[model samples]
Target: MSQTLKQPRNSTERAGFRVDLQGLRALAVLLVMCYHIWFSKVSGGVDIFLMLSAFFLTSSTARRIARGQRPPLVDGWLHRFSRLIPQAAVVIIGVVIAAWIILPSTRWLELIDQSSASLFYWQNWYLSDHQVDYYAFNTASASPLQHFWSLSVQGQIFILWPLVLAGSALIWKKFFSRHNFAWVAGSAFGAIFIGSLAFSIYITATNQQVAYFHTGARLWEFALGSLLALALPWLSSLPEKIRRFGGWAGLLTVIGSGAVLDVQGQFPGFMALVPTVAAALVIAAPAPRSWTNPSGLLSLSPLVKLGDLSYGMYLWHWPLLVFYLEVSGKQKASFLAGTVLILVSIAASWCATKFIEKPAIAWQASASFSRLIPQSGFKLIAQFAAVAVGLGVASLPVMAWENNVEHRRAMAAAQTATDNPGANATEGWDPSPTSLVLPLATELDSEWQTPGEVCEGAAAPDDERIRFCEQGGTFDGGAPDLVLLGDSHMQHWSAAASAMIEEAGGSWILVYEPGCRYGSDADRVKETCSDFQDAAQDYVADLAPEMVLTTASKTVARPDAMLRSPGEQEILVDNYEAMIQPLLDAGSRVIAMRDTPRYSYSIPECVDSNKDNFANCDGSVGYALNSVNPVEKFLDSRDYGDQVVSLDMTGLLCPEGVCKAVIGNVLTYLDDSHLSKTFVLSAKNQFASSFKEATNWE
Candidate 1:
C-alpha cells in the first residue's frame, strides 16, 4: 500500500496511478492552520484550501451527475452539515459560554450577538460592515469565530456548486456526452475564474476592506481549482514524466508560497494565484507509491491523525487564542507557551472531533437519532428559523439601548441652561433652542451639528492659489478673522471659534469636508473624500487668512496610510510646506489646533445604555488613550511646524486625565468621539479667551 502511494513513473507504464490527493487535503488544511497560528504573512494556505475545496466538491458532484445518477441534494446537504455543524456548534457553544464568563457585560452581549450571526451565513457581511480588524490590534477585542468567515464562504459554495454541476450535466445529456459536459463546465468555470480574478484585483485596489469580505472576489480561486478537476481525465492521459513533473512542481509552488508570503503582502487578489494554481496541479496528478510516497508528508500517522481532527481544530483554535488574549491581555505568547497552547488545542480538537462531532454526525445521519432533530423539512429550514429568532432577539437590546428619547430630552434641557446662563436660570434650562440664546444656539447648530453632515463647506474655486487660502467661499464675514482649514475637526470648533472671534472683533471662515481630515491626499481617496483635501488646500492658500486652524482623529491615520501610502509622509510635508510657505511668506500665520479628545463613551447612546455611569460605558481605555493627537506630533517636521502655533484642548476635555462624556445630563458627544453641538455651543464662552490669544484676535 505504501509503495502504491509513491509518485507515478510514467502515465502508460502505470495503470491506475494514485496521487493521494487527500494528502494534499492534509497539506491545504495544515497550511491554513499554521498561517492563522503564526506566520500572519501568507494567505497561500487559504488560497490552496479554496482550490482544494473546488477540486473535491465540484469534481465529485459532476462525476456523480455524469454517471446518470441524481444526487440527493437533501442528503448531500445533510452530509455537509453533519461534517461541518458538529464542530461549528461545539466551538460556538464553548466560545459563547466562555465569553459570558470572561467578558464585560456590554462586550458579552456583543459576543452573543456576533456569535449568533456567525451560525448563519451573514457573519462575513456583519464583520465586513463593522470593519472588524482581523489582525487583532492590541487595544481591540478579538472575535473568536472570525475564522468562520472562510468556512461560511465554503458553505456558501457547497450550497450552489452542485446545482451548477447538475444543471450543466442535464444540458450535456440533452445535447452531447459526459465528456462534452466536462469541457463545457470547464469553459464556464474558466470564464468565472477570469472575471472573478479581475474583480478581486480591482476591488482590492479600490476598496480593500470591502474586497476582503466579498465572496464574489474570492469565488474565482475555487472555480479555477474546479476547472482543473474537470480536466483531470485529459491530464491523466499525459506522459508519466509530465504528470510527475506537474505534481512535484505543484507541491513546490504551494510550499514555496507559504514560505514567501506575509501579512503586509497583498492578498485574495492576483497574489493568491501562486498557491491556488499549485493546488490545481497537485489535484490533477495521480498518487505516488503508497508506502514510499512523498505523500507520506501528509500521510504521517501523526499528521493524518491531526488531519482527521483538523476541521474541529480550525474551529476551536481562534476562539481559544482570543480567550487567552482576553484573559492575559497580551498578544505575543512565549514560544514554549505557544507550543503548549497548540498541543492543548489539538487535544481539545480531537475530543471535539471524536466525541462531539463524530457522535453528533452519526446521530444526525440516523434520521431518527439526531439531537435537536428538525421535526421539519431539511434541518436548514429549522436552522434558519432558529437563527432568525436568535438574531431578532439579539437586535432588540441594541435597538432598545439606542432608542432612549427621554434621555435626549433631559440632555437637551441641561445643555440649554449651560449655554444661556444670563437669561434667567428659570425652571432648569428651557427645552427649546428658540429660547434665551442668541448666537449661542443658532450659530452653534450651523457649525457643530446634532448629527454631523456627510460633507460640508464652500464651493470649489477655479484658481488653486486663491482657493486653498480662503475658508468657506472667501470670508463669510461671520466672527473670527482666523480661518479654519480642513475637515470635520475644524467644524467641531467652529461655534467656539466664532464666539471668540466675535468678542475679539475678528471674522471666521471655515473650509472643510464633513467626513474628511485636513490635508488628505486626493489620489489616496476612492469615494467622496478623494477630492476633499485638495479642494480645501486650494481654499486655505487662496484665502491667505492671518491664521489657519484644524484638527483630526488619530485613528484616521491608519486607513489614510493604506489609501495613499509610499511617499505619503514626505508628500504631506511638501504640500504643507508649499501651501503654507506662500501664506507665511505673504504674512499669513498658520495655527495647528490640537484636536479635542474623543469621548471614552458614545455619548448619545450612553445616556440610554448606562444611564449616567460614564466609567462603565467606556470600553478598554488603553486604545482610546493611544488615539492620535494632531498637535502632539505636528511640530516633528522641520518645514511646516516652524510656522505652526499649537493649541492643546486636553485640559478642557480631560481635566486631571479623566474625561466625562455626560456632565449632569449634558451629553458631551453626539456619537462615539466627536463633541456634541449643544455641548460645544455651551462651551464656546470658555474658549473665547484662548482663541483671542492664539489668533491675536483684537
Candidate 2:
C-alpha cells in the first residue's frame, strides 16, 4: 500500500484508491535495462511488460463492451500502429541509410532485403529460412531489425486479442450472464492463461530457445495480467495491512525473479510466472493511508521518466549498441559509456515521440485521415498509395542492381577467384599489404563489390536462375554423368557446371540439403543431413552417375571439437572417407572440392564496415588446409587414390598462401562461405573448366 500515491480529499478519509500503478511501470523498465545491459540472470522485465500489455488491453476492451457497443477494431489497430511505427520506421530507415554508406555490396543487398522483410513483419520467416538462431550471440547476425521479432509477436497478439474478448463477452451475455461479463471473461481468461503457461513450460523444457522466442509460448504472461485486472476489484476491498503485505510480496517477487532467473536455460515458461504474478500483485495492491508505503521508490522522477520512454528506449538501444560496436570494433565498454548510450537513446526516443509519433497519431485521429465510409473513400485511396509507394521503393533497388553489367562482372569474378582454382594465383588476394586502410564509418555497397548469380543446376534461387528440377530426373542429359549434392554451398556452382554438362551432353543431377550437411556420414547434422544423404544415395543408385561432386567437410559435421588447430587434415580426410564409402560401393567416382576460405574476421561484419583492405580478411590457406586434419597421417594411411582429387581453391583464392575477401575489383564471397548469386553466374567459365577436368564433362 503506497500512501504517497493515495490522496485524501479531507482529513476524514482517503479520497483516491490509487495504488501507484504507474510506479510499477518504472520497475519494469529498470528490470529490462539491467537485463539488456549486464544481467542475463532474469527475464522479469519482459514478463512485466507482457503483463502490462494484457492488463491495459483487457481493461480498455472490457470498458467498451460493457457500454453495449463493439470495440472499434480499426481504431484500436491504428492506435497501436501509430504508437509504434514512427520510432520503428525511423530506426529502420536510419539503419538502411547507414548500411548504404558503409557496408560492402555482398552484405548491403542482403541486409537491405532482410530489413525490408522485417519492416513488413516477415522477419521471423526470413530468419527461419536463414537459420538465424535467436539465442546465438548477437555478433553472428548483422541485421538491426533482428530485435523486432518481439515487437512482431506483440503486434500479432494485439491483432487477435480484442476480437476474441469482444466475441466472448457477447456470447456470455446471451447465455449464462445475468448482464455480468467481467467475471465470466475473467474465469475463461484464467483457464486460457493456465493452459498457455503449461504449454510454455512443456515447450521450454523440450526446446527453450524456440519456446522463449515464439509468441504462442509467451501469450500466457499477458493473459495472466488480464486475469489480475479482473481480480483487482476484489483485492481493493482487502484491509490496508493485507494490501501492504501483498504489495511488498509483489515487489520482492519481481526483484527476486530478476535476480535469479536466467534466459540461457529453460525460460519464459514456468519461470516467467514469477514476474507476471509479481507485477499482477503490485497492480492489485490497495492504497496506503499513511507515509509507510514502499511504492514511492519506484515513482521517483528518473524512474518514472524512464518508464514513460521505455517503449522507444527498447527500440533504439540495441541498434545503437550494434552500430557503436561495429564502428569501434570493440565489445561493450565500462559503465560510463553504456550509461551515456542509454541516455542518448532515451533522448532520441523523446525526440521521436515528440516529433514523429505524437504528431502522426494526432493527425491520423483528425477528420483528414479518418474514413467515415467503410470503403471507396479518400482514406482508402491514401492507404493504397502509401502501401504502393513503399513496395515500389523496395522493389526498384532490387531491379536496378540486379541488371548492372559491371556489378554482374564483378560478382562473377569474385566467385571464380574465391571458389575455384584457375591460372591466376593471386586473383582474389589483396596486393598492397603495407598500405594503411581506414575502416569506413558507414555501411554501403559500391559496384565493385557485387556478386554474380547462383550456379545453373544448383538449387540456389536468384532473380536470374529460373530452372527447377524434379527429384528423380536427369539434370542435363544422361547416366554416367555428374551429380552434385549438398547445401547452399554446393548450390553455388549450378550455373557454371550445369552449362558445361549441357554442352558436354552429360546429365547433371542436383539435390540440395535444405538445413542439412552434404556428407552422408556426419551424424552431427542429425536434423536433416541423414535424410538428405538417404535421398542422395537413392538418387545415385537410380541414376548410376559416374562422378559425385561435393565440398570438403563441414566444420559442424566434424566428429570432434578439438580440430580447430593447425595440421588436422587427417580428421577431415576421415570425414570424407566416411561420406564416400557408400558412393564408391555404388561404382561412382567422388570428387571433393576444397572449401572456400572464410575471412579472418566476420565476413558480413567487415562488409558492413566497408573494409576494402584485406588485412583483417586475410587468412592462411595452409591454415585452412591444415584445418583439414592430420594430413600426412590420413593420406599415407588411405588407399582411395586418383578417385579422390582435391579441387583446391588456393590457386585462385589465395596468393603466397594467404586467402582474402577482396580481389582486384570484386568481393570474394557473398557471406563467409557461400558464393554470391551474381558471383556464381559470372564464374561459369572457370567452374565449367574445373568440372570438365574433374569429371571429363566434355
Candidate 3:
C-alpha cells in the first residue's frame, strides 16, 4: 500500500489521433495498483510511465521542429507543470487536513516538510538525502505523501526534456539543415540512451535504494522512449502478420512480467527493458495496416475511460491507502477493505479529472488566463504568475493551520511549573521531578553538552592540537569527582547523571562522541573516535575521578546488520573490556551499566496517538532489547570479578518484562532509542539509591 505508478499522460495526443495508448495507460495503472495493494512487488509500471512521458514529449517536440515551429522552452515548461500541479495540489491540501486530524503531533513537522518538498519538485532528492526505506513498510507509520517522489521526478524531467529538444533544434539549424531534425535528434538521443543505460546498470547494482529515486539513474528509460518516437515511422512499414504478433506479444509480456521478475536490485537495469519495450511495441503497432486489428481491443470504452482518469487515480490511491492504514491500525488492509478503497479511489479519480483537471487545463489555456493582458509579449510572465499564484494560494492555508495548532500546544505546555521551587517528595515511585515542570514530550534539554563542546563531525589532524573538548561540571562548594563517557546512548542519560553528581557533593566531566561507540578490538573506528578515545584515556589518567560511568552496550544498529551469534558476542565483550579496563587501571572505579531497551518505532508518537491508555504502546522486552544489545547480554552472562562493576538498570525501565513508552504520567523515551531528560530527571532518587548501593559511596 506504500506506492503505485501510473501513466495516463495522453501519449497519442501529439499525433493528432487516438492511437489507443489509453488502453496501455489502463493496463499500466491496474498493474501498479494490484502490485501495491496485494502483491507487495514492483510491476515495472513506473519505468513504463517514464518511457510513455518521454514518448509523448519527444513526439510533440519533433512535430513542432518538423514544421519549423521549435517549442518555446519556457512556455512548454509552464504548460507541462500547469497540466500536473492542480490535481497534485488538491491531494496535498487534503492530506494536510487529514494529517492534522488523524496523525500524531510528532509527525507534523516531517509531514509539513514533505508537503513543501512535494510542492517544489525536490521530493525525490529529499528522500534520497534522508535514505528513505522504499522497500519496506513498518507497522507504525507510513508517509501518506511518499508517492509524490515519482511525481517530483517526472516534473523535473518535464522541464529538462524541452531543453534537450531545444539542443536538437540548434544542431539541426547549424550542422544538418538539409536533413529532417528527426535523424539528428534520434542520433543524439541514441547516444544518450547508450551512456545513461550503462550508468543506470552500474548505480542500480551498487546502491539500489538511492538509485531507485535518483533522476540520473532512471534517465535511460526516458531516452529510450525519445528514440522510439523517431523510429516508429520506419517500424510502421511491417506487414500485417508480424505487427499483429508483436502487438499480442507486447500485451502479454506487460501483463506477465511482474509475476516472474523480482525487481529488488535488478530494476532500471536490463530487467526494466521488459516493460519499456512492451509499451513501445504497443505504441508502434500499426492499427491501420489491417481491418481486424486485435489490438483494436484497446479502443474499448471502459478501458479508455479509466485511462482518462489514470493520472488522478495514481495521485489519489496512495494517500488513501496510507490514511486507511493509519486509521484502521492495520499493516495491510483486509481483502474487503482494499476493494472498498479501490472503488473509492476510482470515484475520486473520476471527480478529480472531470471537475478539476479538465476545467483547470481548459481555463489555463484560455487567452485571459495565459496572458497578462490582451498583448502578446507577456504570455510567459502571465503563465508564471498564474502557476505561482495558484500554488501559493493552495498551500498557505495548510501552512497556517499546522502552525496555529503547534502554537496552541506549545502555549498550553508552557503554563506548567510556574513556581520552580522544589521536587515533589510524596509522588509515586520514580516520579518526574516536580521542581521544574516539562513540556509533554520534553523536547528541550538544559543538561545537553556534547556536540558544542567538541567539533562533532570534525576529523582529527595528523598531529594533535587538542583533539577533543571536554565540558560539564558543577562547583557548588564541592570538588569535581565524576566523569561520564560513551556514545549518544551514554549522552542521553545526562539528566540522571547530573542529579547524582549534585547529590554526592561534586562536579562532573563529560567526554562523549556521537555514534562513536567506545570499542577497542572490533571493526576499525573512525579517525575521530580513535583520537577521542586516546585523549579520553590521557584525561582520565591525569585527573582520575572517584568513578568512571559509561554505557557498555548499544541498540542503534538494525536487527539484520547486528552481530548476534555467541562468537560475535564474545568479540563485543572483548572490545568493551579493552575500552573500559584502562579507566579501572587508572586508579578509578568504573561502572559500565547495562544499556536501556530500544523500540522499533518512535515512542512519543505512539503514546500521543494512543493517549487514552498509553499502555497500548507496551513492547515486549525482547523486541525492546532486540539483536543489538548482545554485548550487554555477553557481559551479564559471566563474571568479570570486582574490577569492573556491571550494573543492570533494565528493570527500572521495563517492569514485569514489558517496556511501555510511558510510566508515572511522563513519556519514558522521547524517540526510538534515547530516554528523555525530563523522564530521567524524574527518576533522580532511584538513580541515587542504585549508585549508592553499587559503589557504597555517600
Candidate 4:
C-alpha cells in the first residue's frame, strides 16, 4: 500500500538498517499477491505495509525534530511523492491502455474515472462512494485499479501525517520544554489511535463496506506504527531471548492471519489488530543473534532484493491479474498461472524500479541539477511538479475520449423522442434507424431517475426509514399530490411518472430505499427492509394522497428460466393487499405496477457487445413475465371495491412477446432489471395513458 520498498539510505544508516523490516516488506507483498491471485481474498499484507510506512516516516521525522530541525514538511512530500508518482503513473497509464484494448466498451468510462482517481490519490474515496465490495470475487468485472485504494490511503496520510507531527512540534515548542516533545507527539498519535479505532469499530458494525475504504477508519493503523516507532528504542532494550521469541511468533501470526481470519469481511476495526500488531512485533524485534535466528531468515539477501522491488510489484501485480482473468475468461488463475503472474509482475516491477523510480530519484539527487536549482526545497518541489505534469499529460487522451463519449450520449438522449420511438415502435411508429442507442453504455450511472429537487419542509417524510425523498412540480397546496413508494424497481418508473404527474397539474413525492420493496412480507425481509416498509406504509397512510404507486410483483431471471415463483407471487399479493388496506382506509386509490422483466445479463452491455445481431440479447416475455398479470389475481381475490387497480406496461417494455435490449434505438434496461431513464421518458405518453386509466383521472 505504501511506497516503503526502499527507505532513504540516510535514514537507514542513522537508524542502523533494519534488514528484517525490508524482508518483512517482501513477505507482505508476496502474501498480498498470493491471496489476490489464488484466493480472491485480502491478506493482512497491505495493513502491514501501511504500518511500516508510518513507522519509517515517524522515526525519521522525530529524529529531525529532536535535533531542532523543521519536520521537512514540503521537501518530504515532494521527495516521497516524486519517487512514488512516476511508478504509479506508469502503471495507471498502462492499465488504461490495456483496459481500452481488452475491456468491453461499457467498462471504458469507469476505467478512465478510476484511473484519474488512482493517479490523484483519491481512488479509495471513489470506490467508497460507489460502494465497491473489495471482498467480492468477480475478478473479470473488478476494476484493474482497485488495488490502488490502499496506496491512495497511504498517499493521503503521507501528506497529512507530516503536518500532524509539525503541529505537535509547535505545541511542544510553545507549551513545554524540548525534552517533552516525545511525550507530546506520543499523546497526539495515541489520541488519533484511540479516536480512529473507535470510529472504525462503529462504522464497521454498521456498514463495513464504506468503513473498509474510509481514510479516518484506517488512520489508527498508521498511528499504531507511529507510537511503536517512538517506543522502539525502549523496546530494543528488552532481553534478546524475548525479542527472538517475539520475532518468530509475530512472523507466524502475520503469515497465518489471512488464512485463519475473515479479513475481507472484518477489517480496519478490532480485527485489524492481528496483523498490525504482529507487524509491530517484527519491527520491534532485535537483529538476529546468529544465522539461524528468526531475524536472520528475514535478513536474507533475496528477500532484501524483493523488498526493493515491492512497491512497483504491488502496483503491477493486481492489474496484470485482473487483465489475465479478463483475457483468459477464468474465475481464478491456476497455481502455475498465478506463479507466472508473480514472476511477470516481479519483472515489470524491476524494470519500473530501475528505469523509472531510480532514475527519478537519481535526477532529484543529481549534483548538476541541484546546482542549477540551488535551494533543495525548490528543487524537490520542481521535481514533484514535473512528475505531476507528466501524469496529467499521460491522462489527457483518456479524458478526451471520455468527453467525446459523453457528448455522443447527450446527442443520443436528446434524439430519443424523434429517432428512438421506444414503446411507440410497438404502436406502428416506424422511426428511422440510428447508429447510436440512447443512454449509451458509458452513461449507465445516470440511468436512475430523480425528481426536480430533494423534498423538504412539508413534503419531506419525518421518518428515518425514508432514506431518500424527492419531489417534482410546485408544492403549492392546490396541486394534486401523488406519492411514489417502493424499492429501485418503483424508483426507475419515476421519470415517466413524475413527468406525467407534473403535466397533469400535480406533484410527486418519491420515498425509496434501493433494495427494500414497500410491501414485502416481514418475516422474509431484513430488519432494515422491514422497518422501511412499515415506515413507508405509515407515511402513505398519513399523507392519504390521491394515488400511491408501488410494485405489485418481483421477477427474477436465470440462464435456465425467467419468471416469478408461484409461492413468492402469492405471498407478494397477500402482502400487497395488507399494505394497501391502510391507504384504502385513508381513501387513497392504489395503483400497483407490475414489476418489469428481469434479464440474466446486463442489457446495455449485451447491446454494446452484440451490436451486429441484437436478437442475441432479446428475451421472451412469456418466460420473463407471467402470462397473466399477478396483480390481477390480487384484485380478483380482494373486495376493495374499485379502491385498488393494476397497471401493467409489459406490452410496451417487451413488445410482441420479446424483451429487446434496444427498443426503437433507445436502450430499455440499464442493467438486467432496471429501466433506463431515456427509455422511460420515450415511453412517457404510453405510461401516462396507463396511469390515467388505472386511476380514472380526468
Candidate 5:
C-alpha cells in the first residue's frame, strides 16, 4: 500500500515498485473474506496484513528521514486517519441505519455501542469489556463490527508508530551511525520484537480471548515487519535463485496458512510468526526472475486493483455477512448463498474505494489544511461530536419507542394481575399464567439491576468472600441472614426473596455464583464460584440462617438428558445436598426453588417477530418445565431433611400447557432460562404467601 502513502519524490523513485506487496494485500483480504463468508474460520490473513502495513509505514518514514525530509508526523497521522475515517465512518453509519431497520430493537444498544467504539477505533477494548463471546457464532448474533477489532489494533499502531520512529531517529542521529538509519531502526525493531513476542506468548496461552484483540500482544507482528523492511537491502543482495525461492516459499505459506493452522484460537503468539515471517520473505525477495516468481501472479493488474480496494473489502465484508446471517437465521451459509454475499461484498468494496475512498483521499491529500490542526486535534473533537450526535439521534428515539411500548404493556399486565385465578402459589406456585406485561422486545436493562445493585465477584485480599444483601436496600453485615445460593437462576429470584425477607423481617444474604450450581469442595471448576459455595456452606453453618433459598438447575439445555436422565440433575442435587448439609445440621432449612424454562433462541427476538401471539415463541410444557418435570421427581427421591422444602414455579410459568416467553406483562425469562428480576418482582405476592405457609415465616 505504498501507493496509499505520499513519499518524497526521491524516496518514491528509490523505494518504488513493490506490486508484490499490493498483491499480498489482495490475497490477505480475500482469505479473510472467504473464510468469514463461507468457512467460518480465521485465515491469519489479518495478521499478515498488519505486518505488511507496519513494514510499509516504517520503510516509508525511514526513507523520508534519510532524504532529510523531516517526518511530517501530524500530517501523516491526519493523512492516514482521514484516508481511513471516511470509508470507516461510511460503513459504520450504514451499519447503524441497517441495524435499526433490519434487527430487532433488542440489538440496537449493542450496535450503537459498537458503532461508537468503531468510530474512535476502540472496538477491541469495548468488546472485551462487554465480555462478548467472540467465538460463539452459534449461540449469539455476531456483531457486524466484530471484525473492526483488527482495524482498531492497526489504528492504535498507526498513532504510536510515528512517535517511536521519531525518537529512534533522534537517538541514531545523535549517537549511533548517522548514515546507517536502517540499522538503528532495525535494531530498535529487533528489541521490540523480542519483548513483545514474549508478552504475546504469555498472554495468548493464558487468556487467548483477550490476547486475540490486544494491541500489546500484536505489536510483535508489526515489529517483525519493520525488522524485515530495514533488512531488505541485505536480503535483496542474496543470490537471485535464493531470493526467488524465498518469494515462492513465502507465497505458498501466505496462501496455505488457513488450511494448515488453527488461526482463530492460537493467533498472535508464536503461531503468528508463520504468516508474518512469510510476508517478510516475500517483501525482501528481489525482483522475481522469470523462473516462476509468484510475484507475477500477485502483481496481476486485477489483483493489484483488488488490493487497492482491500481496505474497503475488509470493512464491508463483515457487516454484509452479519446482515445475511440475521436475515437467514443460520450459523453457517451454504456455498451458493455465501458466494453471492462475497460477490456483492466485492462490488460494494469496489464502489466504496472508487467513489468514497479514492475521492476522500485525493481531497485530504490536496487540501490546504494545516497539519498543526491535529496538534489541537479538531479531527478527534469533530469525530466525538459526530458520534454523540449520531448516538442521540439513533438511540434516544428507540429508547422512547421501547419505553412507550413497555408502558402500554405494563397497563395490560396490571389488568392480567387482577383477572387471573390465583392458585396455591406457596404449596405449588400457580398464579395461573396472566398476560405478559413487558414487550418481548424489551431489553429490561432497568429490570436487570438484580440479583442486586452491588452484586459481583468476591472483592478482597485475593480471597473470595461471601456476598451479603439485606431486604429494603440495606446490608447489615452481622444479621441472621436469609441466604440465596446457586447460579443465575437462584440470583434472578432475589427480587421475590428480598421482598419476602423484608416482610418476614430479617437481613438477607445472596450467595450467588453465575455459572456454578452450588457444588462444593472442588466439584466446581471455576475457583471463585467454587470458593463462593464453600464460603456459603461455612457461613450458613455458623450463622444458622432461618432459610437458605436456592434452585437446583442448569440453564443450558440438556437435550440428551431432559427426557432420559437430567444427567446434570444428579450433579445438581449432590451439590445442593452438600451445600445445605452443613446448614441442615445447624438447624437451617433449605428452600430449593426449581429452575425455569430454557429456550434455544433469543426469546426477545422471537417475541419481536411474533408480538401479537407470543405463545408462538413458547416451548412445550413437558419440554420446558424444569421445576415440575425433572426437578420435582428428583426432589421426591431425595431426603434432604424434613425442613428442606421444594418449590416448583412451572405451574405459574406453564399454565396453559406451554411455557410462554411473557407472563403477567413481565417478560418471564431474561435470556432463555433465568426469570427477569421484574418477573420475579411481579410474582412476589404469591411467593411471599407461599413462604409464610411453607416455612411459617413471621
Candidate 6:
C-alpha cells in the first residue's frame, strides 16, 4: 500500500538486513494485487502495509529519541516524500494520458478530479466526501486511481505519525528519563489504537461506504503497528518454538482471511483486527533458520526483490487493470488476460523502480557545487516540491482541454429551444441536423438539475430525514405554490417544472433524496427512506401547495432485459396510492408524472460512440415502460375522484414507441436513468401544457 521502510535494529543488534520484513512486504503487496485482479475482494494487505509503515516509523523515531538525539522531523519528511512522490507522479501521469486515450469521454472529467486528488495525496478524503462504496460492483466504470486511496492514507500518516512521535519524545525528555520513553510512547499509541478502533467500529456499522475511505477510521491500524514495534523486544524473547508457531499461524490467518471473512463489508473495523494482528504476530516473531518455516520462506531473495518493487507494482497494477477493462469492454478480466496484465504491470513497475524511484531514492539533494546551493533540508523539500509542481504543470493542458469541452457544451445548451427540441421532437417536428450533441459526453457529470436555492423559512422541512430541500422560481403573491417530491426521478423533472413555474409567475419547492422512493415500503428500502417519506408528507400537508408532483412508477431493466414484471408494476402502483392519500386529504392535487425509462447502458457514452447513427442506441418504450400507466390503472380501479391525476409524458419522452438517447440533436438521458437538464429545458412547453391540463391551473 506504501513504500516499505528499513526496520530499526534492536538495542542488542546493529542495523542490518531484514529479510523477513522484506518478504512480508512482498507477500502483502502480492495479496493486494491478487485480490484486486483475480478475486475483486479486499485482501487486507493494505491494512498490513499501513501497520508496517507505522511500525518502522515508530521504531526508528523511538530509537533516535532514546539515544538522546532529536528526531530529524524535517529531513525525515522530505526523504520519505521524495521517495514516494516521484514514483507516484510517474503513475499519475501515465494514468492521465491512458485515460484520455482509452477511457470513455464520460469518465474524463472525473478522471481529472481523481488524478489531481491522487497527485496531492488527498484521494482518500475526496473519495470519502463522494461517499464511494469501494466494494460496489461497477468495475467497468470504476476509477483506475481508486487504489491510490490507500497510498494517500499512508502518505498522510507518514507526516502525522512522526509529529506525534516527536511530541511524545519532547514530553519524555522534558518530564521523564530516556528509559521511560517506551512506556510514554506505548501509552500514546495505545490510546490512539483504542479511540480510533471504537470510532471505526461505530462508523462502519452506521455508514460503511464512507467509513471505508475515511482516514480517521484507519488510524488505529497504524497505531496498532506502532504499539507492536514498541513491544518487539519483549516479543522476541519468547521461546523459539513458540515464535515459530506464531509465525506460521499468522501467515495462515492472513492468507485465509479474504476467503473466510466478509472483508469488503466488514473491514477496517473490528474485523480488520484479524489481518492486522496476524501481521503483528509475523513481525514480532524472529525469522526462522529452517527453509520450511514461514519466516524462512518469506526471506527468499525473489520475494525480497519483489518487496523492493512493491510500491511501484502497487501503483502500476490498478490503473493498468482499469485501462484494460475499459479498452476491452469487459466486466472482469479473463485469467489469461489477467496474467498478461500482471506481467506487464510487473515490467512497468520494474521500469519505474529502475528509472524513477530508485534514482530519486539515491539522489542527494544536499550535495551542492557552490555556496548558492547550500546543503540543507530546504533543498531536499524543494526537490520534492519540484516533482509535484512539474506533474501539476504537465496536467494543465488536459485540464484546459476539459474546460474548453465544457464551455462548448454550455454554448450548445444555450442555443434556441427550436435548435434542441429534445422530447418535443416526438411531436413530429423536423429538427435540423447539427454535428455536436447538446450537453456533450464530457458534460454528463454536471447534467443533474438543482433548484435555485436551499428552501428556507416555513417552506423548509423540519424533519432531519428531509436532508435536501430547495426552491426556485418567483414566490410572489398570487403565484401558484407547487412542490416536487420524491427521489432523483422526481428531482430530474425540476428543470422543466422550474421553467414552467417561472414563466407562469409561480414558485416550486423540491424535496428530494437520491435513491429513496416516495412511498417505498419494501424491506430493502433504508430506514432513512421511510423517515423521508414521512417528512415529505408532513411538509406537503403544512405547505398545502396547489399541486404536488411525484413519480408514480419505477423502471426495471438490465442490459439484456428491459421489461418490468406485472407484479412489480402492481407493487409500485400500491406504494404510490399510499403516498398520495395524505396530499389528497390536504387539498393538494397530486400530479403524478410517469417515471422516465431506465436504460441498462450509459446514454451519453452510447451517443458519443454512435454519433453517426445514434438511432442504434434507442430502445422500445413498451419494454422500458408499462403498456399502461400503472398509477392510472390504480386510480381508475378506485374512486380517488378529481384529487389524484396521472400525468403521462411518455409520449414526449418516447415518441412512436422509441426511447432515443439523442433527440433533436440534444442528449436526453444523462446516464442511463436520469434526464439531462438541457433536454428537460427543451421540454418546458410540453411540460407546461401537460401541467395546466393535469392541475386545471389557469
**Judged by lDDT, which candidate is best?**
4
Candidate 1 yields a Cα-based lDDT of: 0.57
Cα TM-score of candidate 5: 0.84
What's the lDDT for candidate 2? Answer: 0.58
Cα displacement (angstroms), candidate 5, residue 206, comes to 2.0
Predictions ranked by TM-score, top down?
Answer: 6, 4, 5, 3, 2, 1
The order of the candidates by lDDT, greatest first, is 4, 6, 5, 3, 2, 1
Off by over 4 Å in 1: 1-22, 72-75, 97-117, 127-142, 178-180, 205-209, 262-264, 288-292, 369-483, 487-510, 513-534, 540-548, 551-650, 654-685, 688-698
Candidate 2 similarity to native, TM-score: 0.72
lDDT per residue (tens digit) for residues 422-471 in model 3: 12223444423432223343232332434223322212123352343444
Local error of candidate 5 at residue 645 (angstroms):
1.8
TM-scores for the candidates:
0.67, 0.72, 0.78, 0.87, 0.84, 0.88
lDDT of 5 at 295: 75
Question: Which run of 10 residues does model 5 get worst, by summed lDDT?
Answer: 1-10
What is the model-wide C-alpha lDDT for candidate 4?
A: 0.82
Q: Which sections of candidate 3 miss by over 4 Å?
A: 1-16, 132-140, 238-246, 288-294, 365-386, 405-413, 416-452, 455-488, 498-588, 598-601, 615-642, 650-660, 663-665, 681-689, 696-698
Task: Count clashing residue pairs in model 5.
Answer: 7
Candidate 4 colliding pairs, count: 0
How do the residues 1-698 of candidate 5 rate in per-residue lDDT, one tens digit apiece? 22232222233135365766667788888888888888898899999878877887888898898887777577677656656676677777778767777887666667666776787789988776665441222235689889888888888888898988888888887898546888878877888889999999998999887889888899999898888878888887888778778888988898899889999889879999998888777776766524377777777877777777788788888999899888887888889988898788779877866786666544433444466675336554444343344445445444554455566567555664443322322333343344443533444555542544444222111224554432333445553457776666677778888887766556676656656677544446777776777776675567676678877654345456345433233334455565667878888887777667677676777777776777888887665443344445656788654587777666677776777676644567666666666667777887777767766667
Better by lDDT, candidate 6 or 4:
4
Tens-digit lDDT string for candidate 6 (85-113): 77788887878778777776777777788
- Position 688, candidate 5: lDDT: 78
Instruction: Write candidate 2's Cα lDDT for 445-543 as tens digits.
Output: 321121223334433333222232322224444464677766655666655656666666555666566445556464535645665566565556555
Per-residue lDDT of 255 in model 3: 86
Point out the higher-scoring one by lDDT: 3 or 4.
4
